[model samples]
Target: MAKLKLTAGRVRAFTCPADKPQAFLWDADVNGLAVRATLGAKAYIYQGRLNGKSLRVTIGDVNVWSLEEYREPKTGKVITPGARPEARRLQALIDQGRDPREVKAEVTAADIAKREKTKQANTPALEAWQAYIKARASKWSERHKADHETMSREGGQKIKRGRREGMPDKKEPGILRPLLELPLSSITRDAVAGWLEQQAYRPTRARLAVSLLGTFLNWCSDRPEYRDQVNPDACTRMKKDLPKPQAKDDCLQREQVKLWFHHVQRISNPIQATYLQCLLLTGARRNEMAALQWEDVDLTWNTLKIRDKVEGERIIPLTPYVKSLIDGLKPARVVLLHSDDALKRSPFVFASATSTSGHITEPRIAHNQALKNAGLPALSLHGLRRSFGTLAEWVECPAGVVAQIMGHKPTAIAEKHYRRRSIDLLRVWHVKIESWILEQAGIEQQKEETLKLKKSTAA
Candidate 1:
């Protein structure tokens, strides 16, 4: 180390000595301030003791010590030394018993954190939504996955089938796509409120969309990157802004079954007609019936292995009328082939060439037409399932049997623990309920022949 009055000329001229490997010229004016000379470059450095520990910090490179004005390259005006002020600042921290290196490290860490936060704030809402789904989709059902995708589907083209409620000709934006367009950080309660208001025309769908969005936001809040940026309370705050879901009690009355069956039979699409009828007679959910495979129906055993929502699978009795309907189908198309002459079988019970799901996805068009012809008010597909539960009351069916048949959770302790009805026990009530429904619909069976066939099949 050599003590000197440091200047631009001397700072630039200093070089590391071969014997020492490096050299330092300590500033005479500033305590512990020095210019270090390596073999390749030079920089202003500070060395001191803070609370008995040695501290060293490089202030700046010698090349960037002055402001450059290339317009007057030869006679550029020289400003004050930049590194001197920085070195003095570090000295002040040392005077306050703080290590300058530690202080710089803290500042550098804070800057890095701020940049990261900014980057996360700019993440698109759709991008975050995708990440959220990818992380948690395994826990969701196939229908749950479809619900999210349907709500966020970008729409501008024409749909081939089923008229949309509001915009029949051209499809409009989906319920949640607008919210997903902006950055995740910008999805405030006010923004969501405005979105909900615009979607108020379809209150039922809007309510569902808001609920799903709230779930997505909750997922975002649990993530460390979005924990601070996303307000977990946004969903709660927007709840008051949403419309309360209306209670639905839509079902067919006893007399209406006559017209319901009449209209359903009139439908041009036989597959959809059978689908709607199956939904009513079995009290099965719409998707469950739509997703029915050929393997699920057992003609000989008179049973259906329905894919249930509550339980994984539920075996239900195939009643007389329902069994006849299944038997009447051209078996050649719905069965496995053993010989070259056998008809080609379709894997799906309700097969179609146009549907992406490889079956009848939406029967709404034909369903609505049926409603119009029957002079009945519009009802959802699920309403038919409800009608089954309602109409089953006519035959004095057991509550537990109907509940189990419908895949509903047991409501009472006895039903949950004490009683587990066998398929034969359920079949008794199920067949009687179907008979009562058919009789109410002005449908009469040839009892003698039917009984004979039943006996023959049993033997």
Candidate 2:
């Protein structure tokens, strides 16, 4: 290294020393400021020592970066006009016992830290939701998984033809879709409040969406990467503003069951008709009845093993009339009744030809038509299950026995832990309940005829 009055001309003329690969020409005007001349390019360099360690840093170049016209804030005038003005600032830092290289590194580190935070803040909520779902898909049922997908669905385009000719295309994105694209950090309580207000017209759906969103946020917070990016309790703050879910009581009264059954039997689709009647007789959830598999049903045992949400699976007694109804639906009927090509020898007792699941997805349209025909008030399919529970009280059926048959969890300690009733014991109450329900519906016990029919059908 040699001390030189480094000027534009001198800096340009500087070259690598013949004896060495490179050389440094220190500026005589500014200590520790030098021009580094390598084999090809020339650049400004700052040199200093911190804690007995030598520190050397490249300031910039002669042309691309040089003396920027920076006015002193207090003086409002220029003080330095030489090349590599930043070199002088580095020298001042070196004099203050701070390594310019380390300070540069610290500033660089801070910039990186700020960028990482910004990136996390900009992470899309839907992207996070997908990840959350992926992590949890194994634990969730198909219906549960479908609900999450439905919540984030971009609805299909409106059909221009047929019955839905003028209705707005349901293809619009779901309520959660807008929130899904937003950064997790942006889902504030105020944001949720605005969304809730928009959804006030459909209070029930709005409440469910809020609950799901809360679960999603909680999932986000539990993960290390997104913990700082989301507020898990964000949905909780909006709960007070949400409309309370109105309790549903649209079940068939004792008198209505007969008409309901009469209208249901008149439905052209035998499988749909049978499915509705099964819902009433069994007190099973709609999906549970729809998903009945051949393997789970045993005519000999008179037990229908139903996949239940609360109990995992429940064995309900296949009473005489129910046995008659199910036995009549032979393999030929299963094939002939299904209109959809997709349903070919499916094991589901109530298989559908057109459904994606090869089983009835929903029978609301058929059910509604039947209700209209019956001239009865509208009732949800779940109302049938509720009706079963309500009507069983007329026979003085024990609440626990009814709960067991319905796959409801035991509320009392004795029922949950101590009183594990056998299938035979369950059958006693279940058969009695079915007989009582049939009597109320004005149906005779056609046991002999059903048995004779089954034998003839088998032959």
Candidate 3:
């Protein structure tokens, strides 16, 4: 062994090269031990010798650990040479004449850890997840934003409705409420595990809640920040530790959809009726379609520029039925319909009278009423969007093309960044989708049906 040079950088130069596989020896200068970098890289480690054995510790990157930056693992504070805690421990071990084999073993494990980290090479999970999200930053929106952020943003933590509420409402959205406020890093896997442990007995919600959290965090692991730091144990092997809950079998029956549409047509609020019809026809999100304006609709061209598109403005094909629905709106309401305060200032297509500018904060009561009138289950207005996806798949719409209409980021590997703007294909999807829903709803265009019904009532 060479005499200690007494400088941090020069420490590496004095150490002997490995004579055998995975050798461990103290650096003579500072007695901070050194080890080879992992994955054939220039990384090395600093080991602390205490009690006649080395306590393995991470110094820093091979060339990057400055004298000023050198640290002790226990206190996480800087240490000067000769006064290094590990060196003091080694002196104590020497005085006792007891070999620090246990300490050496710990150092060996620490060295292997340093090498293993080098092998990962790429950015951490949190980093990668953030970058992935940022890359598709344009695709995110409050209407459809939760799907992407559900994981890192604590989308998994489910809050139960109080025994009194029975269901989520405007003041509280039930189990989904609290997690939305927290970031991924703030909650530890232990914290999540503890949360899951509390709810584990409630198999269905427990699985969904934990799975959502796990999947999101798992995705985070692919990124750089959490890859090494976040634990996999919390989410993985869920089926083994806690069984998964059975998922709901969704989709309204054709008769149910027909019954629902009939009631939808009679809902006193014409705009709500029209918005519901549009939902059936276009399968767009409520706000995305609700925020439509007369300008976005081109009666002459028979198309609606779906401005509420999650990604950006997209031109949705307006079918004859969709056109009829729009064309038939009473002229008196058109002014209010497009006015910012028409629906209490909501600017929503289904704006309530209470909202300003036709804008609505939420449509909970109205939507539920419509659903109940249609005699449908407790499905969400959002579920209608899912129905559209299912039906589109049923009708054999090309996966890529349907994804485009849904405003989803394309999954086709070669089609990821494709910006196709042709309306020819979209027209086909719009028509097929409309036919499917209208067929389910039993809505047939009766030219004077509106008149005949009015006359019968008047008579």
Which candidate wins on TM-score? Answer: 2
Model 3, residue 441: displacement in angstroms?
Answer: 3.6
Tens-place lDDT digits, model 2, residues 212-235: 999989888889878888988789
Model 1: per-residue Cα lDDT over 217-248, one tens digit each: 99888888778878666557665665676879
How many collisions per candidate? 0, 4, 45
How does each model score on TM-score? 0.72, 0.75, 0.47
Alpha-carbon shift of residue 130 in model 2 (angstroms): 5.0
Ten residues in sequence with the least summed lDDT for candidate 1:
449-458
What lDDT does each candidate get?
0.80, 0.79, 0.58
Q: Report the C-alpha displacement of residue 203, candidate 1, in angstroms.
A: 4.0
